[model samples]
Target: MIRVLLVDDQTLVRAGFRSILDGEADIQVVAEAANGADAVRLTRELRPDVVLMDIRMPEVDGLEATRQVCADPRLSGVKVVILTTFDLDDYVYGALRAGASGFLLKDTEPSEMINGVRVVARGDALLAPSVTRRLIADVVSRGRRPEPSPRLNVLTAREREIIAVVAEGLSNDEIAARLVLSPATVKTHVSRIMTKLDARDRAQLVVLSYESGVVTPGWLS
Candidate 1:
């Protein structure tokens, strides 16, 4: 079973999500938090497999909470999927840098939201194609990606190409079609990219791809 923590400030939103998620046999909500502070505390206590975090909260806020949770050595396996209404570029980049596994719009369909939690639980990257584009924009808006670090140097040219496609919000199959490669080949490239970058998941890859200057903002379009 996949254990989850719901961390939205609004009672109604939290309740609605809980209802939809609880109906799933494979997912369970082990705890809930109304603010970032509670989220941090509950995260350590429950150690849920995934955290569906809200970006705007009264205390500490989701970004900081995600940072705290991700920084914890005890909860290294925990994954955070940030939930927000606005696709504000800053929040998207901040959450990823803070180590969120992925980001999802609050209005996301129940099925997609369910899949997101499960995906992160399995240790996969947190990006859905649409979300990747936003991350790319955020990286480019800051003027420079490819932070002066060797973290991204591990990727080969082919792997870099794959991440570029991903930043365009292409699905594995879409990437395959566009690149004139097989879906299996696209998947292989994505996997290799993840391995080389030490990216914990796709969400981080999306951030790094943009931040690391692997994909430019203009290239996203």
Candidate 2:
């Protein structure tokens, strides 16, 4: 089962989300926090599989909460999915830099929201964060780049190509078509890439791509 922690300052919003998520057999609403501080507290206490973090909150905002939660070695395996209605560049970039596994619009359909939680919980990435891809490109282009890491050199040529495709926000089928390979083969390559890179999944792969300069931001296809 996917254990989830819901973090939203609005009570009604939290109730609504809880109602929807509680209906899913595979997902369990493990905890709820009214603000970022509470969220971080509950996260460390519960160590949920997925955290639905709002970008704005009292005391500590979701961005800082994500950073704190991610920095904790005990919660290293937990995934934080930034949940917000705004598509502002700041939120996108900030959430990612804070180590969010993915970002999703709260206005997204119920099906999509459920899927987003599931994907992040399973350590896969959401397909609709193209805005994040754009932000990553912009941020790196503006010179807020990270230092080099030799660990990035471990990716094979095929893994490097897959990472580039991921940075472009291409779906698996699209990547398969572009590379003249089958979707299953593309999935295998992606899996291997994640294993080799020590990435929890594609979301972390996206993070590593820009952070490690494996695929430059502006250079994404």
Candidate 3:
């Protein structure tokens, strides 16, 4: 089963998410936290497979909680999927950089939300399409120029191409189709890239791709 921890300051939002996730056969709402501090504590104690984290909260926010969770060597198996209103681009970007596996808009459809949980639980990152655009715009607007990692030179030409495509928010299957490679092959390449870059997950890979200049905001538009 995919165990999940719901972390939101709003009681009604937590209840609603519980109601949606409770109906899924493969998912279980293991616990709930009203703030980021509680969420981090429960995460270390319970070690749920996924954390549905709200970006804003009292005392500690989701972004900091996510950072703490990701940085904890003991909670390495835990994955955080940020929950926000989609307008919080800065928070979303910060969450991803803090090692969040992905994000979900608070208004996401029930089906999509469930699927997103499953995706991250299975070790895949899940950035929403709109979130990807917003991330790029936010990065560009901040004047944080892409500082291509020198380590990028370690990637093969093909791997560099794949990284660019990944930054475009394409799935492994979509990348396979575009590159005329098998899905298995694409997955293998992605794994290798992660290892070489020391990325925590595909979300980190996307961030690296942007900051490393493999993909640019203009290309995204």
Q: How would the candidate models be sorted by TM-score, starting from the highest?
A: 3, 1, 2
What is the model-wide C-alpha lDDT for candidate 1? 0.81
- Estimate, for each residue in 1-221, the C-alpha lDDT of model 2 and write its tens digit: 99999999999989989999999999999999989999999999998999999988999999999989988889988899888765565776777766787788888788888988987776667645666566668766776766766886888788788887887777688899999999899999898888887665576777777787767667644
The per-candidate count of clashes, in order, stands at 7, 0, 1
Model 2 spans > 4 angstroms off: 127-129, 144-150, 171-177, 180-192, 218-221
Better of 1 and 3 by TM-score: 3
For model 3, how many clashes?
1
Q: Report each candidate's C-alpha RMSD, comma-separated, in the order given.
A: 2.8, 2.9, 1.4
| Weakest 10 consecutive residues of candidate 1 by summed lDDT | 140-149
List model 1 lDDT by residue over 1-221, tens digit each: 99999999999999999999999999999989999999999999889999999988996899999999988889888999989766466876788888887777888899989988887898666676555565547556767435545775777778778887776556688899898999889888888887777666677776676776766666545
Using lDDT, rank the candidates from best to worst: 3, 2, 1
lDDT of 3 by residue, 95-199 (tens): 988999888888889999999999899878896476565565566556667677788999999999998888777889999999999999999999999999999
Worst 10 residues of 2 by lDDT: 127-136
Superposition-based RMSD of candidate 3 using all C-alpha atoms, in angstroms:
1.4
lDDT of each: 0.81, 0.81, 0.88
Q: Candidate 3: which stretches are off by over 4 Å?
A: none
